[model samples]
Structure formats: structure tokens, C-alpha cells
Target: MSKKSTEQKPEVATVALVQSAQEEEDTITIPVMDIFRQMKKYFLPWVLIAVIAAGAVFGGAMLLSNSKATPLTAMVGFTYDGIEKGLDPNGNEFDANTLKSPSIIESTLTDLGMDTKKTDAIRSAITISGVVPDDTIDELTAYKSIFESTNSVDAAQKLMDVSYYPTRFEIQFAYGNSEMNRSQAADFLNTMLSNYKTYFMRTYGYNDALGDALTAVDYTTYDYPQALDVFSSTLNSLQNYVSTLSQNDNTRFRSSETGYTFADLNESINTLRSVDYATLSSYVLGKNVTKDKASLAIYYQYRIDNLNRNLSSANEKLATIADSIKNYQKDSMVVMAGADATSSSALTQPSEAYDDLISQKTDAQSSVSSYQQQIADYQSRLDKLNSSAVASKKDQEKVETDMKTVCDKLNKLIDDVNATADDYFETASYANSYSVLVPASGSVSNAVSNAVSNMMRPLLIAEALLFVCYLVFAIVRAFIVSYRRNAIATAAVEAEERKEAAEAAEKTEETEE
Candidate 1:
């Protein structure tokens, strides 16, 4: 071999040995300046490639990190410079809720044409923003924080620009539409948002009719159909009592004795109803039916007392008549000259009465006439009023009427009691069970509580699937980077050396030739 080739051969073999040793591991050791010099050519390309790859990976990761879609958007023509502009109650104040409310959001999205299967992925990738009248610092701050945590933007270029805002609220939502092409991202978000808005509108307005019905009083009644029989019976009894009183000469008419007297009854009714007599003046005005009845009662009692006085006066007159007859018999003695009281004369004259006897008889007859006159006058008056308005007064009638009224009231009271008892039985037996221990409102809230027992399993399953996907993707990314680095190191180590060496030995070859 030539001297030059021979010298280079060992150098190649030594280079091979170094390369083989370095292949097992990656390391760098050189004079600092020489390291820079040795790597100047390769480092430029490697650095450029590394920078580009880093940028690509970072940008790709940013794009992948958030794959959410915009779920709702609404274009309400109205704008509010202040909090007073909109009165969208039912909790429409939260982020995206105002813009993507179930009302107009679904329509807007439908107009935009979004895909359905990418619901969660689009939601995760998207961000929401708004434009409102710049009336206050709050508005500015809110607008500045346009992107949400869910926004996936590794680079500035992935961000969208929003313009065309009025003083009112302008709202938008963004999602990682990675499942869709860049051109289709907006369309997908718009479609899904449309559907979401529709769902929300249906949910929120579910109780509209109930609210309206609650405000209407058309169903209220002074007396329900359930009370028809009771009212009819009450009116019938009152009418019957009035009719009976009208036929009686002793009274003009009578009202049923509901509880209180006439005046008292009316006053009690007004009190219970909490209305003034003046309001009822047009109907009854100054009339006091109760007072009139009470006065009649008094008048009858007075007549009965007067009759008793007259009877007493007549009795005294009878006694006076008896006394007068006795006095006339004693003082009316007529003394005829031959008729002086002689037993012989009285016997001989066939018991002929003397003048004294005659006078006594005359006085007796006069006293009897006076007694007859007094008795006849009294008897005539009594006969004339046998059927008159005051003959019976109210002594017996009062007791009977009072007893009947009391019985009627008791019967009515019993009916009321029975009705109440029946209602209680029906309500308690057939109505929904009541909660005695817990507050009623709390019990109602419990009934309204979510039926999570039916939905929990599916929700948990979805969560688990998402978590698994995230973990797997994360592990796969890490392993790919690590394996690629190791492979690159092995390849570099093998190709780093390009020389081989051979050895030659000759001893006595010249002498034998």
C-alpha cells in the first residue's frame, strides 16, 4: 500500500472504534471554540429545522388543544348603553347565555349550518366574546376578556376578529372546529348554536301558560257548584218563614232568626264581609228590618201588658159591684107605716115583703145590672179581637218560633259541619299526601329536584371516556417524542464515522526472491 493510504488506514480504523463507542450513547466533548466551529455547518440546518418543527408542533397543538365549537349566537337588534336597556329576566345575564339564549340562538346556528355529531368537541374548542355599548369600565373589561379558557390558540393567527358592534350587546362563541376544515368552522358552530338556542327556548318557556293561568280570575266564583244545594236550602227556608209571617194578623212579616237579631244580623254580615253600610245603601239604604222586627216584638209585649191591666181593672170593678150590692141591701130599708117588721104580719101576708124588703130588692137589682154592664163591655172587646192582630200577641208564638229557628240553625250548622267533614275526608283520603315534618316548600322543591338517579350513570360514563381519551393522547405524544429522539441519536452515531483499516506484515520475502 502507498505510505499515504497506510497512514490513513489506521486513522479510519480509530475513527470506526470511536464511532462504535459513541453509538451506544449521545454525548459531546470538545474545546468550546472548536465545538462551535465543528457544528457551524450542521447546526444551522438543525436549528432551522428544530425551530420550524417547534413552531409547527406548537401551532398544531394549539389547534388541537381546543376543539370546541360555537353553540349559540343571536343577533338582537337592540343594544343597551346601560344595564337598563334589556329586561331579559329568567337569568339571561351570564356569559353567552344572553347571546345564545334558547330564543334566537338555534335559528342563527341553523342559518349558519353546523354539524351535529361534534357537539362536545366543538364546545371544548370554542370561546365566547361580546360587543356592547362602551358605557362603563365594566363593559370595556368584559369586552377585553373576549376569549374564554376553552379557547385553543397557540398562535395569534388562529384568533378571530369581531367588529360591527352597537351600544347594545353583541355576542359570539368560538370552538375548536378541528373536526371541520378551517373554512367550515364557522358554519358548524352556527348550526349547533341554532339547535341549542331552540332547545333553550323550549326549556325556558315551558311554564308560560301556567303563569298566565295563574293571573286569571275567571275560575273564581262567589258560590261554587259544590255549594248549590246548601244555598238553595238556605234561601228556601228564609222565603217560607217570610210567607208564614205575612199571613199572621199579629205580625207584618218575619225574617229568619239566623243568629243575631235583625239589626245585629245585618251588622254582623257587614262585619264579616268587611264592607260599609254606605256601599249597600243603594240596596237597603236606611231600612232597618232588624230594628223594625224588634220594635214589633216590643209593641206586642206592651199590648199584652195593657190587656192584663184592663183585665185587672175589670176585676177590681167586679169587687166594687159586689160591695155596692151589699151596701144597698143594708141602707135601702123602706119603713112603711104598717110594714114594720113583724113576724105575724110577715106570716099572715103570705110572707109579703115589706117596703124595706122591696127597697133592698131594688138595690140588689141595680148592683147586678152594673155588674152585667161591666162584664158585657169586657166580653165584647175580647170577642171583637179574637182574630185581630194583637189577640195572640207573641207569648206562645214567640216560644215556638224561637224553638223552630234554633232547630233550623242547628240543622244548618250540622249541614255545614257535615260538608266540612266530607270535604276533609275527600281531600285527606284522595289528595296528595302532605308533609307534616318537613316544610311544604321544601317538600315541593324536593319533588322538583333532578332525577339524577336515572341520568348519573350515563353522565359518568361520558366523563370517563373523555378522561381516557385525554390520557391516552397525552401518553402517546410523550412516547413519540422520546422514541424519535432515541432513534435519531442511534442513526447519527452509526453514520458519524466512514473509515476502515487493514494491517500488512512481511519479514524475509526479498531474500527468497
Candidate 2:
């Protein structure tokens, strides 16, 4: 749009000429040997020294790795069940060098010609070390439970693949070779556990004495019921004699009017019953409870019979008096009064007899009352005893049940101990009991796992040592390169000094000419 001022600006041209920078671009090349020679001239000797030192370090490491430890004979084993998959233990070695990983185990076994599909069929007992991981230890712990639950030789041979790098691989027989076949290995393990169970039962399982008491044996062979009956009869005779004596108040010369009340007779009867029952329960029952139940029963029956007989005699006397009073009429009173004291011989004798009968009747009545009270007390005790006997029977039954329960538990414990010995602990030669190489914790124990994890630390330390060596090499290489550059600079400076000296001499000669 601004065509009015068509002034052209001068353009200055700048030319850039491109040319080859290297003059000997196509010159003959030096051979690799020449380059190496040049490097040797500057750095080979020091590099060689470093290499020799490195070789010495490597040799020392190898010696330590080989001559570091003794072969430990502590027997170790592991197995697993209820896992999503099975572990194939590598039979290379068991030591503190590496961890026992299930994945590693499976991979190692797969490298072999074994198929994992048949792993579930056999029981594979793996002998391993305590340095193994918790997951691996878990398998060992499971061995005990599985062996105890369902164990056999067929079960032991189910595994088709085995990775025994960490654990010793076994199929036909164990390392010790107690059995010639896989079946025998399993059988041996199972039997050891069973024997261990018996040992445990005897060691701390049950109270033998308590069991024996509950299942008590009979002490005496006497006839219980017959003896009781005879005792009752004898007691009855004694009671009857006592009653007869009481009825003979005529011999006692007692006055007809002066007599004890029924209350007094009842108290004496009550005292007799209390004393007898107390004595029986304390002495007779205690003495016979474990020794002679038959004798105790007899004694009890006799006490009851004695009470009955005494009551009967007392009642007979009271009845006679009652009958006399009931039959007494106005005419009978007049006839009794008409009888002179010592006149008509027949009438006097009859009066005397009547007086004697009245006295005897009073005494007999008192005795009858005492006996009746005693009988009542004896009956009450019998009722109490019968109730107690019922409760005692129930207690006996409970005791027997408890004994049986304990026995069953003991048997099961024994079985478990035996299985432990057979399946896992025979090699230890321990007492036939539950013997476990109790982990810092136990199988699959956290401490054990932590210890296994510690294996990685040593590996890390080895790597660190290698890294330090690399660092030292790098530092030495840098120092070497710098020293070579300084040496070359010093040589070039000396050559320049020599050339200047020569030129100075030539100039001096030219000046002279």
C-alpha cells in the first residue's frame, strides 16, 4: 500500500564455505592391538594390580563360604495340607544361607519332569531347617495335624513333583531309612505318634485313684437282707424284755397314785431315739460305707424293730387299764368295795390280784408311751435315710460318669502322643510323649519367620560388599586416569624444553658465523 516511496534497502551477502574438518579422514586405521598397547603403556600395570587384589578378595570369599560351618544333624521336616496348592521342596541343601519359599519350591519342581497335578495324592514329608520361612514352617506344623487326622503310606506318596533345594526329597524311604518304601515311612511316623500318646496319658493325663474309688469293689460277702432281719428280731427281744420289766411295777413297789406323766415318758423315748440314730450315722454308717453296707443295714433294721417291740409292750399295758375303766360300772364298784381287806379268803385274793394288775397296768402304760415315741423318732430317721440314699445313688452315678469322661480324654491324649512320636519325633529319640522342637515360638511362629527373614540381610550385606568394591574400583580408575594425564603433560613440557635448548644452541652458532 506504500508504493509512493519505493526505495530498495542494500542487501549484504554473507558466504559460508563448507569444507572437511579432518584431513586424514580416509587414512589407514590403527589396529585394536595398537590401541590396547597404548592403554597398557599408561594404565595396564595399575589395572593389573587392582585385578590381582580383587582376585585375592574373591578367593577369600570362596574359602569362607566353603570352610565356614559344620554339617548339623538336627533332623528337620515339613509338610502342608488345606493349601490352595502344594509345595515341591528342593533337595539341594538346608542351611542358614537361603529362605524356603513355596513359590521357589514349586518352580524348582516344575523344572524337573514331575507333574504338579498328582501332588494331592501322596503324603510328602519334607526334612528342612529352622532357617526356612514361616509359610514353609507352616507346612511342617500341618504335618502333625494331618498325620494325626488321616495318615498312611499311600498318603505319603501322593506328591509327584519335588523341589528339594531347601529340604531333603524323600519317597521310597527316609534318609535314616527305617522303612524300605514310602508306605513304611508313613507307617513308622504314625506308629511313633501312637506310642507317644500312651506315654502322655501316663505322664499327666488322669487321676487313677479317683477313678478307682468310683468303680469300687464289694468288700464283704455277707447276706445283707437276712442279717438285717436277724438283727431286728434280736433287738425286738431286748425291747420286749425291757417292756415286760416295766409292766412288773408290782416288784418295784410303786404306789398306784404316784406315776410319771406321758410327757416325761415321751421325752425319754425321744432321747433314746436321738442317741441311737446319731450313734448309727456317725459310727455304724461311717464304718460300713466302704467296708460293710450289709452290716450297716442290719444295725439300722434292729434299731427300728427295738422301737416297735417296746411300743407294743407299752401299748398292751395301756390297753388293759383302758379296758378296766371302760367296763367299770356302779355294780362293779359296789362289789369291789364289799371285798374285805383280809376276811373272805377268795375275795381277798381276788382284790389283791386286782391291785397288782392295776399297778402293773400303770407301769406298762408308761412304758408303752415311751416306746411309741421312740418308734415315731426311729421312723422319721428312716425316712430321712431313705431320701439321703436316693441322693447318694445319684452322686455315685455322676462319679462314674466323670471317671469315664476322663478315661476317654486320656485315651485320646495317648493316641495323640503316639502319633507325634511316629509322625514327627522319633528321630529325636525323645521319651514317648508330645515332643516338638518348640520354635523360638513354634512352627509358623512369628519369631521363627522373623529369623528366616533375617537371611535376606546377609545377602544384602554381600551385595553391599560387592558395591563397596565397585566404588573403590571407580575411585581407583579416576585416580589412574588423572595421574596418566598429568604424566603426559609433564613429558610434553620436557620435550618443549629440549627443543628450545637446541634452537638456542643453533642461533648461537649462526650469530658466530
Candidate 3:
């Protein structure tokens, strides 16, 4: 009986071990229902924490943004026709950064009656960048590839040296530190740009040096021959200027204000040179008119000597240039025989150096001819001075009258030409070269949108983080609660099993007795 009891105890122990293993497996397995209940229970607290976090993030962002001075921005665009070649209409290199030059800023402040002390601030606030197109890089890359594939070292070098500039440029004015309101900043930028346009026109549109020189000349200080020389020089300058204008592709363009074309100006200049100039020159030189014959004779001799020296120098230069031209070898390219080509052929062309030499030679010959003519005129004048022919008071008076009349006509012609040229340049020549394609405009709406977006971005991120943290806390809390309850139920089951085992052992001992 004791032996049977020991075997039964082993079976009872096995059963208890199996029951404990089952209880542990049941305790470790978690149910989806408990998780859902815990989440629901913590939903209100999670929402409260999330709302607080979102509020803090948004308020902080707003406060930080508001504490800093928000920049008032304005944009302006430039449309320069000559931007492709990086040149202005006057063949000067174009620089977009010059838009914010100190000179321009100072002028703007002066024009706007603003404080000139803000010049540096305004310059600092101003930023310029080219509005490069999306395809510009691709185009540049393709160009570089094609040139590189050609295997031409010079072409490759030139390509490497090439710089690109955009026709459209963006001008940004950040006015946070400039102490300017949005409206004021916009006005200042627009005024500054307007002043720049005026400056650009004066600097590059048309040259006023010749006009100013002609206007400043006081012909009364010169004798009759010298006065004739002045008129001749002025006419020659005017003819050359008009000739350059006439050579432009838009030579037929007529000025709306002056009602004159370049062709008309050229015609007027030619007529004056041929008719008025010839008449005055003939009258002055033929009469051998002079304010003081002794002084004039001495001047003529000096001029003759100077001119002879210049003529000799010019002749020597001309001879040297002629020899260079005769001995200069032109660059040539040899083409080997091909299916469509002749046996072999060589093509020759004048290099830039050769062409430059030819041009210099032509100019030297022209200078020599001019010097010879001047020397002859001065010698003739000296000869006339040597003669005992003294002009009477009547001849002098007549000469003076003709001189005044011709001077008046020349002055009038100069005035007309100035007016026409000014009108032509302002209205036609440079009218479209540099322009404000887009005027300065404020970005108030965009600024507001950006501020809102900035605030919302941080707020959303904080809220998302809060949500994840709340979920993890809720899940951990749920697991802790579930574990505690399972541990207590497990302990109770083990106690009950021990109690039952004790009772069974007592019954078995009694049965054995």
C-alpha cells in the first residue's frame, strides 16, 4: 500500500506540473480586446497631452517669429536686350551688381528725400541674381560637349573662357534692417530703379562730349582763319558722328519729337560741309583776312614748320607699314585630296594681325595727306602775309559780317543736330535696351503664408511625436496591469492545487491505514 501511494504521488506531481505549464502559457498570451480597452481608457488623457504639446509648439514658433523683425521683401526684374553678350547698348560690359552701387543708392536717397545714411543699409538689403532658365544648364552642357568633341584647342579654350549672363535678373530688397515699411520700401526701390535708368541712358545711350565741346567753343577769340578752321573742324566732327549714326541698321528711324531721321541729319551735314563750309573757307582764305597780320604770319610759319615735321614722321610710318604689308604672310589651310576635292588645295586668308596692319597703313596715309594739305595752306597764308597787300577797314568789316553770319548758321545747325540726336537716342536707339520688365512689388501675402507654414510645420511635428509617445505609454501601462492580474490569479491557482494535493495525500494515508 505504501509503494502504491508513492507511485500515485508521482502521477499527482506530473499533473500539477502540467497544470502550472498551461496556466503560464495562458498568462503570457495577450488578447487584442485588452489592448483596445486600455487604449480607449487612455484616449482622453492622450488627447489632452497632444493638444498641450501642439499649443506649446505653435505658440513658441509664433513668439519666436514675431520677436524677430520680419523682412519686407520686394522684387524687380530687368530685361536687357544686350545681356546675351554681357554688353550694354554702348558696348560696355554689363554688370547686374551695379544696380546696388553706392552712387546709385545715394542718388536714389537724394531723389526720394530719404536719409543718405541708409545708403549702406539699402545696398546691403539689395540682392541681385540672374533668372536663369531651366534649360540653360542643359544648353550649356550641350554646347560644351559639341565644342569638346571637335578636338580644337582654341575652341575649347574659348568655350572655357565663355561666361553667360541672363537677360532677366531678379532684384530683391530685404527691408528688415532698412527701417522701411513695405510701402516705403517698394517706393524706394522703384525710385532707385528709375534713377538708374536715367543714369544708364546718360552714360551709355549717347555721347555728349562732342556736343558739349562744340557748344563751349567761343569763336570770337580766334582770328578769321582760325575761326574758319574751327568751323571746319566742327563740321568734320558733326559729319563723322552723323555718318556713324547713318551706318546703323536703323538709320531710317525718324525721331518723333524732332521729326528728323539719321539720313536727314547726314544730308544736312553734307550740305553744310559742301556749301556753307566751302563758301566761308573761300571768302576767308581768298581775302587773306587777319586780325593782326604780323602775329598771324608768325603763327602760320610755326604751323608750317610743325606740319612739315608731322608730315615727315607720317611718311616714314607709312613706308614702314607698306613694307610690313608686302612682307606679311597670310595664314593658310591646306586641304588634302578627297573624293569631291581636287588633288590638293590651299586656302589663304588675312589674319587679324595682317588686317590690323592694313588698317593702320590706310590711316597713316590719310594722316600724311592731311598734313601735306595743311602745310600747303599755311605756306600760302605766309606768302600772302609777306605780300604788301593790306586789307582796308571795309574788307575787314565785310569779313567780320560774313564770319558772324556763317557762325550763326553753324550754331543753328549744331543745335538742330543735338536735338535730333538726343531725340533719336532716347526714343529709338536705347529705348528697349534696359527696361523694368517687372516693377518692384511687395510680398506681403507670400510672407504671411510662409510664416503660417513655418508655425504649422513645427506644430505638426510635435503633435505627431506626442501621439507616438502616448501610444507607447498606453501600451506599456496596459501590459503592466495585465501582468499583475495574471500573476495574482496564477498564485491563487498554485495555492489551490497544493491544498487539493494535501487533502488527497491525507485520504490516501487513511486508505492505507
TM-score of each: 0.20, 0.23, 0.72
Rank list by lDDT: 3, 2, 1
- Best of the two (1, 3) by TM-score: 3
lDDT of 2 at 404: 41
All models, RMSD in angstroms = 37.3, 34.6, 6.2
Could you give candidate 1's per-residue lDDT for residues 15-51 as a string of tens digits?
Answer: 7777767764465332344333434534455556545
Report how far residue 6 has shifted in candidate 3, in Å: 14
Candidate 3 lDDT, tens digit per residue, 303-356? 999999999999999999999999999999987898977689889975999999
Q: Candidate 3: which pairs clash?
A: none
Q: Which ten residues in a row are the worst by lDDT in model 1?
A: 433-442
| TM-score, ranked from best to worst | 3, 2, 1
lDDT of each: 0.39, 0.40, 0.77
lDDT measured at residue 85 in model 3 versus the true structure, 0 to 100: 76
Winner on TM-score (1 vs 2): 2
- The top-ranked prediction according to TM-score is 3
